[model samples]
Target: MGHRLADTSSPARLAAPDEGIGRDELALATRNHGLPLEALRYDVTPPGLHYVLTHYDIPYVPDDTAWRLSVTGRVQRPLHLDLADLKGFPQVTTRVTLECAGNGRALLTPRPVSQPWLVEAVGTAEWTGVPLRLLLAAAGVDADAVDVVFTGADHGVERGVEQDYQRSLPIDVATGTEPEVLVAHAMNGAPLPPQHGRPLRLIVPGWYGMAHVKWLREVAVTDAPFTGFQQSVAYRLRQESGEEGEPVTRIVPRALLVPPGFPDFMSRARVVRPGTVPLEGRAWSGRAPVTRVDVSTDAGRTWREAELEPDDGRPWAWRRWHFGWTAAEGEYELSARATDAEGHTQPLQQPWNRGGFANNLVQRVPVLCLAKEG
Candidate 1:
């Protein structure tokens, strides 16, 4: 099917200068240029429109200098790896979707306190780098270690608190084969542009972006879980199931249960005669494949199946599904919810969390009916 987004000349701003870019400047780029990012997973987000969330004002790590990836802390053999050292190890490439932990938080009710993201807060890329386990194996992880801490070079002020960016992954996910983790030196086959964490960045293919720290300068193999601000204060999800709510500090790995992509017009709205339109949208599940996508027209009163695109078991990619319905002269609401193969359906509304992480509310895009003019 043909895309509805404008041509390449439309100013999408993926590789533009940061002069006019503001806290929310990317919105225009997403709406104007069909984000050119490819899903690499089932969702198929184009490469150019991937969302970037950073703590610093953007750090540029030069290519000429000899860069190093240090593995310190509790390892038996603390190691420092230069680019050549990393290259000397076996090279692995995996296509995985990377999404901000707070990707869909903007859609939450009462609005969480975090960066407001319109739907474009994620992207997938073919990451080529050395396996994280290989480095850990060389470092000889201590038998009693509990976690591995990753720190990046991006620095910024959060609520007047100046801090270096850091986060941790459990030793299991950090060392597993399915994680397909990388100390990526390149993104989409180029020395990663500085804005996108140049030189070296951690790429945990199936996990959220928080685990894939960019511009990674140091990786500490630790005996205990990390307590960095990004982990303790930010990216913490309020645990609420049915009625009880508690806060857990340990970072839990999240999967792309719902695929990422634009919404489809399930049915056309008509303010005049004979003007018909098509409905489309995207769905994904991080832990499992999306089994079905349900569309609603009369505000949850009636349900219908939207056509789902065939999917392979690619981690973090979204599925594109669509349905077509007739238009009538009236106001209507358009919404979608995805059910994973495991039967975890998106809630009509996700709960409010202090840090605004892991929000997977049913997606709704509003459209108005207007009369055609001659």
Candidate 2:
């Protein structure tokens, strides 16, 4: 493959300011003192801090001069590519939602040992990049290849092991043609932010964020399955101690209700004027398309099918759903649940796991309806 240098004529955007808070403090106070959460209020795609999640305290910023992505092992042609070289290949863009594996860990009873992210840890973005399979095909994978290992630039000691962030997928999944995977270089029409993995990152549509390795530097094609620390040790769902847990893969089905904030509640505590209030939110699944969304205005006692948006056919993107409610003065406990095409549905309560991964429990919102002034 041909190699080229990236155009450096344009000035880079300023990086987001780091709050200088310790990891523990940031995790505990995320809703307020940590990264701001106001962006999550948006209906289409959340903006600012809501768009990305960073695992470590500091994000790695690579110098363009020394940065390169290498593909080796079990390939007919080993290749080294720079940013411009990757951009030279045909570019593809798609909108995908990414959620951290430990998204709802804060809600867990005993709490898991990780970033205590609530629902705000998820976001959707339009990503632009080169198809990863193109690069893999250029390398000509060996017939015996079983797994494709991805190694990121980020490195540190985790769970007593000092290693770079890495993970792998089956060769078929990595090289699949449908719902194409990307070596993404841009997010929301801009060069990726440092917090979201600048220069290059892997985007494994339909999988948890852990499978999308950031600051990607190496792709190793192997004849056997990879047993990397991030893949085999962390990000796995374990029911108890000492048992090898199932690898956290596809996202479970979930539906979120966007509450009517501030002004609506400011008039009265959790109160909305009696009228037709439009209830809306997003629903998604990694295993299959979201087939339906059910909304409940009186806890789980009564339910109504919400109008769902037409799927754009992007497997990784979420579908927006809406329900119009005409209410009289009363108190209501609103909630939403989603069902997927594969028959998987959001549960009232997700099974307790040691890592608190895949917590797709139904979300509820409390509201009081006040009669309109005569």
Candidate 3:
């Protein structure tokens, strides 16, 4: 089955600039929280402060002891392993930065009508689990296996299609060792939080958050490309309704600023005292290491290179960058732009798509430089 479309109108739609956020989007925002810009100061976001977006309800798993992760289909040796059994495998820990494909959806001119995110749907965390390749090796992927489908316990309906929240990886990506994917059971050194996928989750470093199937229970190796809802109908980069656009895979390069100074309660604009002000933030690229970060205090009119910190050896994690600004007493605008080793850079103007995926527009912040008390 390929490209399942909703016969009668669908839930997914786009909102024009003047229409504003609808009630449905607001409700989704209430449940799916964004990372507070201030929390960008931390290298690893705490569970609560980290962004959360659940497509369906968080399934309650009172007893994970009885739960078994089944690895089946197109494999010689199918296996069912319990939580303890998974823990028994030789463990590897990885630091990963997961960003929602729709991180900047709300900022789009005719915004995608789903999550309504405004660039805060991201967080970096230390993930611990058994490497997915190890399990595949043990199971013996069939000669004709093409895609490995991951099925999570969370189930829901989207665009008139009901699915169990499934996604797949090509055989090469599923087995690659370069950035080893994990059947993660721990986040930030602690057992997975309930919202983060209590018993288990699939962590595909560098890929969008949708690829990280949470509350994972089944890993099925398939002989054909998996055309389930997520893999085909959703998450594609289509401009028109039925176009099968490019697949949204590795994350595009993105840089976020730690909003300077304090925020007003409602407006949330920044206020900085006049003088030399320290500026810093994080940058990451799933495509390659973030090689450069540029700061622009006057929108994108001019840019200054910020010093990048040496990579901490975590290939998939975000890197910190710093810049200093001589603050004169005046109103100003601020922004950060990132470039990856692959030469991909943030676009000053966001590229539009139906789903609003991979919108790496430079982050612009408004700042009021207060005069010093004489």
Candidate 4:
């Protein structure tokens, strides 16, 4: 056998230039980012820092002639649409929060086995597009269809295996709802950047990032299950039983379980001296709108209800809340739980799975106490 590895540092890199945007800038953007709560019900999502989830290193901006969305598979009339054709329909927009199912995975203990993401991995944005249902209806989608498969223009190799990021939704998820779903061509208030699926992408709000396939190039309606790598092998939960089998690989709704008061989950480098710190965070749900957010400073022994903001649009957006307590001189554990409108309360700990999908357990933060500043 030849040498197992070659010199590593000299390999070609397709990485984009720094673009003068550093991690600190991104962090600040995330920290200060705000959604127009009043605009949540509208179709236009607010422009900047709209949540983005992508599998490609850079967005592919195709020329107008090169951009085509194919509607094939089980349709009575197969259709191919260009950018102008999609724009001809009366455009609609809605302010929706697009969250990565893996958002906040870094906060889990034992590190929960996946991407190291902080709170910023998710975002809310107003997406404008032609409702996919309209297009599918125009093409006369078959009644026997089971799933809607979406593919994009980006492709690459991972672990020496060629793969392109794509996703599928159940027929119920794809065509059941009004404004049904979207083949989004615009994000926020501007044309999508080349790095952000300029021509088209899918915007299926409330589901995990996997549901919102980007760089959309094709839409196929099928009666059979889509068992591709991105769907079957990658974004699935692994069972601890260690049996050679496929785990349940579908999107399940999860709620953002925020405690009454914000607890710092980790040490802060910004604080020179520590004192009583005020805490605040946001809570949300997918199954139902969050009704009550509870806080527990004494490790779930005693609980208090935090003040909750009025409902924005029922179940589509997160409600913000606040909690405050005097910092005592010692180490403390802080935690939060959320209850949905249907009386579904968040669990203290969610079960762990192999692929670590949808881990929305109650959020806990560790805080430190310090002497009063002189």
lDDT of each: 0.64, 0.77, 0.91, 0.62
| Per-model TM-score on C-alpha atoms | 0.76, 0.86, 0.97, 0.75
Residue runs of model 3 more than 4 Å from their true location after superposition: 1-9
State the weakest 10-residue window (summed lDDT) of model 4.
Answer: 7-16
Candidate 1 lDDT, 1-374, residue by residue in tens: 68433322132112133333345535533332222222323343444556677655567655625677899888899898888888899998776666666666555554543466645466666778999999999999889878899988888666445677888887887888866678998877777767668888988765667778888889898887777766765555553323223323222222221322233435422222324545666665566667888887666668798888876655445666767766555556666777876777766656457556666665554445544444
What ranking of all candidate models by TM-score puts the best one first?
3, 2, 1, 4
**Native-referenced Cα lDDT, model 3:** 0.91
lDDT of 3 by residue, 1-374 (tens): 56655654377788865997888889999999988988888889877988999998999999878888999999999999999989888899999999999899999988889999998999989999999999999999999999999999998778888779999999999999877989999999988999999889999999999999999999999998999989888899988987988889999999999999888889999998988889989999999999999999997899999999987898898898889999999998999999999999999888999999999998889999988978
| CA RMSD of all predictions | 10.5, 9.2, 2.8, 7.4
Q: Please, what's the RMSD in Å of model 3?
A: 2.8
Instruction: State how far residue 175 of model 2 sits from its true place (Å).
Output: 0.4
The lDDT, on a scale of 0 to 1, for candidate 4 is 0.62
| lDDT string, candidate 2, 1-374, tens digits | 55322331122111124423346536545532222223434433534554455544445565754679999999999999999889899999988878777776666666665565666567778889999899999999999999999988887666556678889989998899765789999888888777678878999888888988888899999999899877887777787756799999989988887765333435333567787888888888988899999999998888899999887766788888889988779888888899999999977765678777888878667788776788
